[model samples]
Target: MSQITSPPRKARQAPVPAAGPDDGARARRVSRLKRRLTPYGFLTPTGILLVILMVTPIIMVITYSLLDGVITNKNPAFIGFENYAEVLTDPVFFKAVRNTLVFTLTSVVVHFGIGLGFALMLNSPLLGDRIKGLFRVIYILPWLFTVAIVAVLWRLLLSPNGVINYLLGATGLTEGQTEWLANPSTALAAVTFINIWSGYPFFMISLLAGLQGIPRELYEAARVDGAGAWAQFRHVTLPQLRPIIISMALLDFIWTTQQFALIWMTTGGGPIDATEVLSTFTYKLAFTRYDFSVASASAVLVLLMSMVLAFFYVRHQKSRD
Candidate 1:
């Protein structure tokens, strides 16, 4: 053993080579580069789309709003707030704002109310399952129909001697034919009704989903605690559905406020602009009058109002949460 001397200590095996400093640094740098590029690679499509579709259009609108109507082609000469001044001063624009608010609020409220009722009815065990399904289908059918088709159908029905007037006459409710869409007073109301009809089903489906998500145990517990039907609804269902209700109301407001196709196709904001909302007004300004700057200014104002409403809605929801 002593002679062996551990075989010269096995030649004292050479120390294993460690990675070079530059190699380690290079690996770390590659990892960091990959980490940096991964998120950007994922977001690249969305960023590009926003830049092309949303940001570009918004910038163009703002640019046009600052220019004169005659500056469509070539270099646009900035008028420096003249368009804003005109829009703010215009009575028609103010009227359109008022009408838009009224339409939005009224439609939202009515739709919510009717849709909530229908949702409650459908959720009831007393109703036959087949009947509920049939009703749901019927209600949702209108929502699936194209806006142009709905407008045309309603326009035909609201004509002076149309089906509605015919039915009213048959029922002895009216003396003769009625021009529902022709009269200014009734035109807005009629359009509002049609909007409600088309929109309520969406609210119904949404609220029904919310309602069905609630646990049946809650209702049973409420009943066991001697809560009546109305009390149970007041204490349980309404509370549980609050978030959904508020969100749907806000969505309905935005949709109804910005609606153009139905109103344009049905009345063209006619009957003396009784049904004219901001969208229609903007369209008339830009296309009919060829005042793109004023139109863009008005559109910007509308966008601001929508943003404010949305901000409040989101804040309210967060606070509730």
Candidate 2:
């Protein structure tokens, strides 16, 4: 009876159905294939664009810069650094370098200061929303105008017997109408001012975004700790905003150093080369003097300088991070 009570042992069950070896292997292979393809799929477009737009032109520039005469139907004869040597020794090139540095440094400092001040002011409670928006639009309008239009407008304003002279006369600031652009001493300053006016809005908008990203709680905490406005800004805002400021300054320096249109339109690198920057000098070399090699060499130098600035900017950002 006891033996019978042990019910007949259940028939040996077949192993539960398991994933087939082929199916499991196929799925793993498919996943690995997709993982390998994903990165290439994303990079393909950018890689193609860089080769087409950037690498090709740079190769051409380097090749052309080595030649002696204008690159025409005839194959160019490589002159091995001749163009670079000539440019380096030229007085005009040296002058252009000096002017470029001055313009870049002045613009960077003025633009940063003015833009930061405006951003701070907009962040203040004294300025109502509507008023701040209105001012923002007005300040940004100059940036939207093309360089040619800005140059023409400023030329008219700075012309003899123009509105500036009229206003100055009315204010008893000058004896008579002055030719602002004709005077070499004042021409560079006038052009620099125009550049500052046109460029500062870009920095202002950038800094404003950076300012808005900062948390109000940080400021409140600092206040609770008996921090004054200057102390709070110094300890918190400046540190947080450092990266943005450095990036903007580097960009501004590169752009300002290569400025041509405003200088060309307003002064044509004249009042005796007073406003000649690298870009303008390159243009003059290429077009006016018919020296393509020199122009290319100058452009390459400018590019190298920009790269150096970029290197520093990247290093600074990495350190901060």
Candidate 3:
């Protein structure tokens, strides 16, 4: 009994006070929530603007595509896909689609090739920083020129009596002056080349940014493992730049497919339909032929094509991740 009671009872500790509402912690949590939510608050105006400008127009186009009258009429009769039927059956529509595919594919391929080459050159040690900056400016200058102005400038250059033909004659590169944009055989090629020249700089800049982001340590490690220039490029460089290349190519395809100004101003879809693309075709349908519903249907087709491409691209990116 004495042994059982021998252990002195420890003094009962005072009960700790309960937290009073934790107002400071709640205030901190509320502050954090505000910080996280602030960006969306700032973006609300721009979101509203895009909804008004982009979404509203897209909806209008879809609605108009179902009708069978020009916008000038007070009442546009809903034809229910007849406009799409007309567009699908029109031979010119098929030709325009073919031309657009060919132009976009060829231009984007060449753009990637030439742009990657320039990016490599710029990233090389051969160029000093100042030289690199100068070349960058020179390459992007043509792209920065408004396409309308570029179209006019290139028209002058490609004309039979212009500086390009004169230079070709002087250099003995041609037997005589050649029309780059007039002849059916040369119109598509000439337009594709001009577009390539103007647009490749975008790819170059994008690829160069990707290149700069790649760790130099990777190249060093590859070199330590017996990687040569080609080996390093094939393994290290290409893999690193693949995402940028794909994204740029996707965007270029979409944009180049919609090319109107250059083709219209330079060739006007030409001696034949050599340069006719969906954009110019749609334009002709709307203004020249005064068929607004049909034009809207064609535009809807263009939008659908772009969406399909984007879907595939996004799927590919997700699979990679």
> Where is model 3 more than 4 Å wrong at Cα?
1-40, 313-321
**For all the candidates, what are their Cα RMSDs to the real structure?**
5.6, 7.6, 10.1
User: TM-score for all predictions?
Assistant: 0.89, 0.87, 0.84
Candidate 1 Cα errors over 4 Å, as ranges? 1-17, 20-29, 70-75, 316-321
Candidate 1 overall lDDT versus native: 0.89
lDDT score, candidate 1, position 19: 92
User: TM-score order of candidates, best first?
Assistant: 1, 2, 3
Clashes of each: 0, 0, 0
Q: How well is each residue in 190-212 modelled by candidate 2, as lDDT tens digits? A: 88999999999988999999999
lDDT of each: 0.89, 0.88, 0.89
Q: What does candidate 3's lDDT look like per residue over 45-114, in tens digits? A: 9999999999999999999999878677888887899999999999999999888988999999999998
Between 2 and 3, whose lDDT is larger?
3
